[model samples]
Target: MSTVLAAVGAVHPLAAATVNDNTPWVGPGMMGFLIVVVIGLVTWFLGKSMTKQLRKLDAGRAEQQEAEGEEEAEAAAPAPAHDPKLNGAH
Candidate 1:
């Protein structure tokens, strides 16, 4: 296995060897571009998801506030229950 690997490494040049030695920036530039594209996609998707969640939270909050308002209105109304012990009629 070691001999085979040595022969292969000695005979086959790397794919990059075909490019000009003076052109050092090409590989690094392509990697940077790919990184930026991936980051941009992630940021865009995250922003869209966050906005959707925020809208849902706002809607839920509004519904809760409306229900609380209705409960507050009920609290101010008079109670009409009559107890027999309080009226000395038991």
Candidate 2:
């Protein structure tokens, strides 16, 4: 174990590789820009579709609520009164 430790300690650290200053550094070119544009357009279309769907859902819910309100009103209204004479009750 001590011999292994000594051997490990004797090893020197490697130096980093050098880069050429003459070479130009290239970045993400036209392809990256096209990809971003496509993604943006797709996202915009999806958002529009989602908005349309949500509006439909909201309209349906409103109609359902209106129908329920009418039903409740009908249930709560008082019935027509009957005359005693009409039923032969004097």
Candidate 3:
């Protein structure tokens, strides 16, 4: 245990010499903030574009459905019966 203690004591000075208090520590600054803002703006724009496209798609589908309903109603209706009296044929 004494030898282990002596070894640890010898290494402490080397460890203390490697550390410098004068060097500055830097964090995520303006560039990081700009990147995050750009990402948020891109996401917002994409969402708006997707909503516009979905609205257009819904409008087209409604128009198509209306046209199909009209066609079906026309095809289902029967023709009027012929009337000779009304035509003045006796």
* Per-model TM values vs. the true structure: 0.57, 0.68, 0.63
TM-score ranking from best candidate downward: 2, 3, 1
> What tens digits encode model 1's per-residue C-alpha lDDT throughout 1-90?
556655655677552343324654656577899999999999999999999999999999999999999999899878878989899995
Taking all chains together, the TM-score of candidate 2 against the true structure is 0.68
| Inter-residue clash pairs, candidate 1 | none
Which should have the higher TM-score, number 1 or number 2? 2
Between 1 and 3, whose lDDT is larger?
Answer: 3
Off by over 4 Å in 1: 1-27, 80-90
- Where does candidate 3 have its weakest 10-residue lDDT segment? 13-22
Quantify all predictions' global Cα lDDT against the true fold.
Answer: 0.81, 0.80, 0.84
Distance from true position, residue 60, model 3, in Å? Answer: 0.3
lDDT ranking, best first: 3, 1, 2
Using lDDT, give the best candidate's number.
3
How would you encode candidate 2's per-residue C-alpha lDDT over 1-90 as one tens digit per residue? 556545555573221111213467788899999999999999999999999999999999999999999999999999889889888997
User: Which stretches in model 2 have alpha-carbon errors above 4 Å?
Assistant: 1-15, 18-21, 82-90
Residues forming the 10-long window of minimal summed lDDT in candidate 2: 12-21
Candidate 3, residues 19-71, lDDT tens digits: the string is 52357778789999999999999999999999999999999999999999999
What are the runs in model 3 whose C-alpha is more than 4 Å off?
1-24, 82-90
